[model samples]
Target: MNARTADAPAANPTSAPAGTLLHELSSSPIAESLRRELLKRWPSTPDRVREISRYALLAPGKTLRPLLLVASADAVGGSYDGVLPAAMAVEYLHVATLIHDDVIDDDELRRGQRSVHAHYGMADAIVTGDFLILTMFTSLAECVERGVPAAAVLEAVRVLAEAGADVCRGQTKEAELTSDPSSPIADYETVISLKTGALFRGVCRAGAILGGAGPDHTEAVTRFAEHLGLAFQMYDDLLPYLWEPGTTGKPNTSDAGNLRPTFPVLLGYESAGRGDRERFTEALSGRIPAAEAYERLRELLESTGALHRARARAETEAALAREQLAGLPSSEGVGLLAAVAELSINRDR
Candidate 1:
């Protein structure tokens, strides 16, 4: 979803149609209650970590992951009250990853504010990230303390840990690919699956497990979230190229400037004519100005229908996510969950 600052100008009226799923979700009592509980549950800590945590955690968060977890629980006829701990713990894990991600990407801002590392320092950012991860465990333990079944909490923890490991593995793979233009498309897809899809699948499964869903139902939700997550990151990869500066809360051409092998980039190279392929590779090599390179690559993508191909693939994944929702019973929560899946691609930033 697009990030908007309090004072940022309204949409350009020229960008792609922005979806209302996030707006609709934010207005729901389910998401509203989750936001209130999150704010209340935030920990008091040393001034530095508290400030950093507050800035990152309480930013204009969509709370999509937490919402998904709670809804998944409700979809299976579980109690939302019982699933709150899982939902909060998932937020802890997600926010911690965001902190670490900005540090790794050397990004200067987040959600329209200075990044933790930029506002604080690398050391403070690292420590604050670790503190948030520790809180994830606290939130998980709270589930059992709150009278959720011990066995269910244990299963959820196992899945969360596995997903966390996959996240790290995916980050490592991405770092390895940063300089190698010849890196196969396999590497990019694997990275997206591990880095993005892993957490999405894990949280859904964790919620289902909390709801006492059987293995079959849990598996269905897990698969559904996997495709949804991949669609999310793929759209995220496209946003830097598609969005105007400030629309996405970061430099629009940073991805191209950094020469990363994003989905569109790979497709553009494969589909372009021979001469355009050479220019496309040159633009991606960072040997020229990022702005010029960004425009050139975008042109190549459009000419070769690479943009259309990539968008179609993302739409397909999103549709697959919707298909998986059929096993879930009809409810307001289910309806919201379906809308979120649609939001994965229809977003403007």
Candidate 2:
């Protein structure tokens, strides 16, 4: 669906549209409760760290990771309540990474506002990120205390740790390529997959595992999230070139000005624009079950056409992900899960 539609309640606010997945899933009671729990977990000791962390973590976001957890639980016939702690853990970890990412990138803004480092200074921001990471571990410990098996908690932590490493590697790779105009598309994909896809995969897999889904189902969910996350990063990269600062509610063109090898830069402006259109077309080609929603999504992405080829690759990956879920049991949550994949492919911000 279009970004606005995706963000808004369906045509009927009282009842969700048929196949209008993620609308309520993201706003589910379990997800909301988990968000509250996470907010409580932020370090409250020193006023400075607490303030910086709160500002950074409380920014407006879709809270997609927790939604994935709750949705996966429902898909497996499990109670979303059972996985609330784990879901919060995932979100805490994500915020931790974002905090560190801002510091590393020297980003001046986030979510249309000054970044923590910019507003609070780099030292405080770095400590804030560290506190969040530690809090994530504590949250995971709470999950275990709540009767989730030690194995499940451990596995989730492993995945999160690996994802963190992948993010670091991706950042390093991106740094290396920033000044090099001839970077290969494959390299860019690798970076995006490692940096962005890794955490998305971890979130889905952790959700499935906590939901008690079998290994195969967890893998399927992970694959779906991975592809969707890559598409998210690609689309995010394109935003800098296509949107004005206030229009996107965030600063634009940092990548372009920094000489980063974004899709538009790599493919050349015209080719990249066309590629985005083609990808949007492919995403809406009815090759997947969520094609109708994908059409709405296509309309959103086609406005930019700045990362079409990367988007096309994401479409292929998303199609494969849908195929992977064919063998899983059907549930209302599955539709929401699929919708999340579609949304990721076409999200505007």
For each candidate, what is the lDDT? 0.78, 0.65
Residue-wise lDDT of candidate 2 within 8-106, one digit each (tens)? Answer: 222112222323444454565544665676577665556876677778777877678777776666666555556777777777778888878778767
Q: Name every residue pair that clashes in candidate 1.
A: none
Question: How does residue 64 of candidate 2 score in lDDT?
Answer: 80
Residue 188's lDDT within candidate 1 is 86
Error of 1 at 61 (Å): 2.0
The per-candidate count of clashes, in order, stands at: 0, 3
TM-score of 1: 0.90
Shift of residue 208 alpha carbon in model 1, Å: 0.9
lDDT of 1 by residue, 33-144 (tens): 8888878876666687877887788877679899888877766767777878888889888989988988887878787778889999999999988998888877887788
Off by over 4 Å in 2: 1-31, 39-46, 269-307
Candidate 2 lDDT trough over 10 residues, lowest sum: 1-10
Query: Which window of ten consecutive residues has the lowest lDDT sum in model 1?
Result: 1-10
Output the number of the TM-score-best candidate: 1
Return the lDDT, model 1, position 241: 65
